[model samples]
Target: MDIAAIKEQLPIREVLQHYNLYPDKQNRLRCPFHDDSTPSLQVYYKTQTAYCFSSNCATHGKSMDVIDFIMYLEKCSKHEAIEKAKTLIGGDNQLQRLTRQAVLTKMFSYFKNAVYNSKPAQEYLQARCIDYRQTEVGYNAGQFHHGTRKDEALIKSCIEHGLLNDVGNKSRTGDTAYNVFGKWCIVFALKDSSNHVSGLYFRSTLNNQDQRHFYLKDRSGLYPKYPATDTKKLILTESIIDAATLLQIPAIASQYSVLALYGTNGFTQEHQAAIQSLTQLEEIIFWLNADQPGAEATSKHAIALQSLYTKARISCVKMPQGEDINSMAQAHDNMDVFIDLLEQRTADFSFSIEKENNNAGEQQEKAKLFIERGAPKQPTKTPPPITTGELDSTNPYKLRYERDTVNYYIQGGLPKTTDNMKIMLVIEDKASTQKARNRIDLYEDKQVEKLCKEAGEKLSLPAATLQADLYRLTDLLEQLIEKQLQQARPPEQALPVLTAKEREALQQFASKPKLIKRLNELLGKAGIVGEERNRIFLLIIAISHKTADTLHALIQG
Candidate 1:
């Protein structure tokens, strides 16, 4: 069989229809050569060619290639494949015919009218919080009737420049408008490789109301549309509004191309394929919602496309807490903050195993003991002992006493004798003070023992001599305690009542600035005018007027 004759006799459409190998509304086909899960192979009726689009196995070729593929699948030679192709064509010439541009023009017009007049498409936009009129181009009722809405100014300008039909629209919905038969619909236009209007979408504006209402259109992948001359970068957002929001940023104003994904959940294989086909695309930034699902989808799509375009860098732009891009734009006129955030953005899912391992190693080292085992233990240092005078003079203790006494005096006061007794008991039994005193005594005992042992070992002296020194130190401690107690005792049998002279002197000391100045001068001369001495003197003055006996007892204490 002559190969050229066989090609002319092949019924492409009939074979496709017989095997259910027809392209969907988008002119896409499943790989007949392989068990493809999706329609990874596409047939362009206009070009009369087929191509495999799977990333794993992109085996694209012509009609002859298709015959060759069938031959291979059926385990037959080229002659057998030709015979099978003849049988599949069934002598149908209509199968080989392609639809003309006039049909596309008619389809676009029908859908555009359906979308503008359809209540369902209007409601869908409303439900999604999108206002068609608020977009860059105003809506045209007549254009809707014609199945295309071009920017009037853009069309007029292009027409003047002899560039007619240069403007077009890409529907958010996929290709289904070609089948819309008197259904409520929303429509958008499709553009060719030169960005000329090629198709239209007509979708149901009403949702969840009826099963028969559905329509969409796409003219994207076939277009060789170059971004505006000023566009050097591209920003991919989840919505058209979000894409507009990017243009609002001065940094990105004319420097980038902005495209909308329509929604987070609506990303399909066609969308991915469209994005992957952009040869001029250098970098793609996924500016999605700052939400869990949005982030997840962004990551998934970013990863999927990264393989298709190696230079593509993916980063997520998070909006302010609880605010979306629309709300943020309303709150702030400038996009400085948002742009800054984008510039500083990083891939949230990308991480380094080596860094994590280093962190773990550092933590393990931190957990190890600092000191080596079996080293001689260093002696614990003891704090300096507090003498009875210092204890009685301290501001903390004096303040405590004053506070209690003031409260007591206001409350008709505790008896003087009872107060003194309570003070003594507290000094002896309070846990902190008792602990401190015990530690001091234990340290002293250890020192004495150490001294005696050292003397016995070094001077060959009797341990009894060191024991005598320890005994003398103990006697001195006892004497100090006795003296403190003796001084604390009252002089009178029943504490002497305040005399008139004493009362006058106390009042004068408290009220006269001259007297206070003189007292301070005398205290300075005596080298006792510092904080500790002042506190001691103040305590003495505050409690001294109770009785001569109390004053003497306090001095001793």
Candidate 2:
């Protein structure tokens, strides 16, 4: 609101302090835009702007107002700087509001006409990667109703609307009206959701000027000035120029609607209301500048959208660091960069509050399911306590535990079990490291007992301990052998044998190349392979045929 008034009234010192920047007794501070060794920025209270004398600084020898300083410090757009300026200026209505639609239209038309006349302004827009012809943008030469019969009335109205200023003297056209936007500025028509022009946004063509961004007194409205009622997807950008930049890309403009925020803190009540009205909205993606403030804003707005529109998919497209859409578009002449980055949007927990909530809900649901189903059984039983000996080639398996009679073994670094079909018994001297290993066959109990006795005598261990160990080993071997036999030869039922004629018919059916190819394809889809797959194919064909006699099949391993 009243951007000119704010710049005049708001002191540069106050703006500095708001950002926690303090100037010494000399009213100087280190330049924040670049690496500075000392305070090179000098504050001029008379002009209410700060200038850095450091040649290495980006703002070297340039006077920056409250808005410009904010833009540089926040690494945001000019529109964002204006929004930040509003906060520093305290309240809205610093000047009278421009409510006359007729006058606003005339003003917009004048600026729109100026774009065609000025080649430099056109080049500036083109350099910024903005399509002024397609998108509703203009060049403000700061000439409002020059040399017209209605000059006095127009000047008075423009002054009241903060579009013109009274220089306290009559001009060549006999009016005290001085255009506030000045010469060489790009004009953008900021429109409401209903496609009505609500305000005007100005960006200076002069790079040397610090206060390059300016908005109409009442900075309220979205860019593009169109109905978003049918838009299923929406793109939110940080600046109007960035939104305009997206509008130039046919791919983006055709499918998604772009809404520009003034700054990181620029999401207004009007923006919220406009978005809420989009009943058909399926997704909302932020294409803000790739800076710290932009990142923070993207997350903040994404969370807000999640809370407000739970069904809408909220996400953000990360640009190159410190680059915005317009700058990136300008760098790369093609739209593929935008499309590629759009495909890689981050809308998960970082951006979406609903995603976080859903994750928590999913975890709770999993816990509930576990309770209802009963806790899952452990894949293996708890292992026995073991004191393992050093690995050796002779005894590959480690000792699990040393009982009074014998030592148990852990086979293959895992818990000893009957499934592995490997077991060992170690008989060792209680006083020394000497030990004896006895390997026995599961079927030969007496032979294993004889070997155990001989090994025990070699180690000088008690005969009774060796005998007890032999008994224990025999029982374990018996169970393991039984388990192996059961696994290797599972129970089977008797099958009827097919007649010679039926078998001949099945063999004939399985010989077709087309059928075999189709069968292989199906088997491939089911992840079946090798010789077993061929057997299954034959089996399928055998079962599909109408056979009067029962079928007997033999498969090779």
Candidate 3:
């Protein structure tokens, strides 16, 4: 096939319209390619392409590519896609070659005559609350006779405008038959910016059973007419009624040119290009329905305009809840408030860091709980308590006990138990409680001094404090375990190396009580309360020795 001929025969505008590839200035349509929470997919008439820049999906392509993309989305073949495209375009592929000018001329003559002569068509427009006089067309009730007695002046005008052609025969019901029939239509000339007729729109009477009323016929390659000055702003709405309603708004009329899409689904690349071609527009306001689809389409169209002209300001004119522009205009005599609503529009894009943080925090909490419930079991054992007089200066038990008590108190634990232990030492021995307390205090103060010096080199003040407390607790516990090993004297002959389980139990008896108590006190200071603190402490105890060792290695590292 000749590519040039195919391109010429295939109207790009019509193809885009067929695939619903019009810029949704209102951001209303869900992107067909992916599950998008917002409409970021932009369709443009100037470039004849659609693209999505939002993070949701990467869809960008020409009109034909859009169809192919839709096919992929539907999981269908190209042939099937074309068939669907044909249905959407509202015509078969063969009809594309037919001269639209010829069709318009023939159809208009028939419709103009019917509108002037038929009582039913007149009543239909009136019943729908449409004022036919504003269209500047003549209407005569006597021109619709079935035979030769038909009004000659109406017939002559119809023929001259190329709005009628003689069919072979009259209907048996006695109505005059014609090659083109517009029994229920209101025909009008659609002009361009140059005030020349470019197309004809045949709108059917309101009472017709078929809701499909409007038909467009291009006059050669002429552009659609818009009633805006080169430098003025323009407001685009979805329907003719909406356009008229908006025009009646004094503020909108004073500041902008208004036009309608004619229907919700009437958007086409030709229409988009025509609007964009207006070089004088500083901004374009999309006055669309305030529903989901309308909002989505508005955003898409806004993106398209932004892509074309970096400086172009796009805004949306939102309608009141459950009310369209036409209805709202009829209800209120003033348009100032409506225009104010448009001026106050805001950009519709945002990111939520708080939401992300909440999600991550919830996941961490869940994992912690799961580990607590699924931890492996361990055994426990008891050790001999140290006597007052036997607690010699070089005895490891005495040194370890004093060190552990001081470590616990410095790490935010209560000093009650450690004070009691010191008092018991003084009463049972000749040593003074104050002297023993001062000794333990001096030892803890020296350890803290060393920790603070190390932490100061590595962290900020708050972080350093936290590090010092953790380090002090760990060092005291390790010293206590060493003391337990010396005092236990497991058989003295070293008969056999202790099993991993026995070794772990011995280590626990040496260090577990003090560590658990310190951890519980730290939890309380951190605002953990009641059953929660108890649960967390129990969970720590239930952890396997191997797991605890791994955790300790991590913390120390």
Candidate 4:
């Protein structure tokens, strides 16, 4: 069989599954060629290609057709890769041909008309800064059309087209999947190379997490087409909304053809075919989320596209650290910086995908220990005392850490108060140089024991309890601090201090027997006695009794 025939026949997703090179819910994977802590490989099922977005790895931007995958995975020559793939694919099943394309187009047209007339869907696009009229937006009449509100014509047409699974609409009675058929949802038509409506995607206008995007089984793995008028530049985004937003930009609209992957993981063989069709396309830039996964994807896709289109320049336009393209577009003040960055062909910094990170390894171990020790059983607002460097309260370990500082971890559960148990993990350097693996306890290791005592004191919890369960103790302490923070006024707007003259004027009231009596009582509440409490009492009195002659005189003074 010809190599191209085999490539066409082999279901890349199945082949990837066969090799245990799988994508997650987000359709990301660690590049097999690199020791990636984060998944960097994006497998485009429709495109039948995989790209390692890890720029630091040798395979960075390396675009692999199924044959390239075989070449890389088997470390074989072209002929060998083809031969090995032949064994892997066996007799591969072909993609299910979409038979009702014409029907789908008609339904999409009706839905698109519905969306154009629907006030809410129009507002939804307007709110997203998308011009529905100009952008070819449609509506998905989600779980709303029922009883008298049902569009029988649409339903009958869909049934006629065999577009829906259940013929009589009996499934809509209660079947979760089938019941959703006639519901109103916003529709977006995905186009193929010939500008034919190859797919219809339905996205809910409301904030429903579970039902974000609804695609018919036949339409799966297709990219939403955007015009590639300037074949020299192509911009790929993670979502249709983002793609639409990018196209609205004057610079982007004039100089680029844009495509949306529908999802982070939705790049398909069909999209790859469309990309191959971009004969004059020289640059393919990824505009994805600026997160760990996004960064990895940007790198993976960039590398893949560069290799796939060796003649084309492949680079990434980095989104501002925490902003997505939509948010960035909305920020009128930030457009210049964003546009400047997007105009560039290379990234300032792409994370190291191939480097073996000891910190990541240690954090993974600590997370294992945290979970094993029953984190859920003793839940805390503050995380476990795990450190992956940086004081991000977001990390699993809530332990405070300074770069290159010595931090200790205990083995087993909690040790007795000052029992001086052995330390299992020791973080010596901040960015790197993390060391951990069980070691014997030294009886003379008083320093770690002392740290425990200090922690107990700082936490205001009994030493025994704090030592017994670090996670629970931290939780209690964090809860208390959170409560206090909630009650306390912000420091910037704290009550004003009295001047020296006011203090002297208020000194006269200090001699009052009732004042002295109350001041002494407050000493107990304040956890102080004698001079310190006396001064605090005077200040308190001055703050509250501003109308008193002595206090007012003190304030005036």
Off by more than 4 A, model 2: 1-99, 148-150, 172-179, 350-557
TM-score of predicted structure 2: 0.45
After TM-score superposition, the amount by which residue 119's alpha carbon in candidate 4 deviates from its true location, in angstroms, is 2.2
lDDT of 2 at 257: 89
Clashes of each: 10, 0, 21, 34
By lDDT, the better pick of 3 and 4 is: 4
Give residue 411's lDDT in candidate 4 (0 to 100).
21
> Which of the two, 1 or 2, has more lDDT?
2
- What is the RMSD of candidate 4? 26.7
Whole-model lDDT for model 4 versus the true structure? 0.58
lDDT of 1 by residue, 258-312 (tens): 6666567656554565666666676677777766777767766676666567665
Residue 429's lDDT in candidate 4: 30
TM-score of 1: 0.31
C-alpha positional error of residue 459 in candidate 1 after TM-score superposition, expressed in Å:
93
Error of 4 at 389 (Å): 26
Q: Which ranges in model 1 have alpha carbons more than 4 Å from their true place?
A: 1-192, 198-232, 244-253, 265-281, 321-341, 347-557
Model 4 Cα lDDT, one tens digit per residue, 1-557: 88878777565664665565545434467888778899889876557788888887776767788888878777879999888777654333222222355446545644655664688888888767677766776776653235533444445445544445453344446632344552556667677655556767767788788777777656643444645544777888887778878766677677777888756666677777778877888777788876787776665565555547777766676544545677555433223434665764453222222434375564222111011221334545755654433332332212233323333332222222233332232223323444332233334335435544565454343445433333333343354446545666465767889999999878877876798567667666786655764565566666766554544324322
Candidate 1: RMSD to truth? 36.1
Q: How would you order the candidates by lDDT, starting with the best?
A: 2, 4, 3, 1
For each candidate, the alpha-carbon lDDT, in order, equals 0.46, 0.67, 0.48, 0.58
Model 2 clashing residue pairs (backbone): none
- TM-score of every model versus the real structure: 0.31, 0.45, 0.36, 0.42
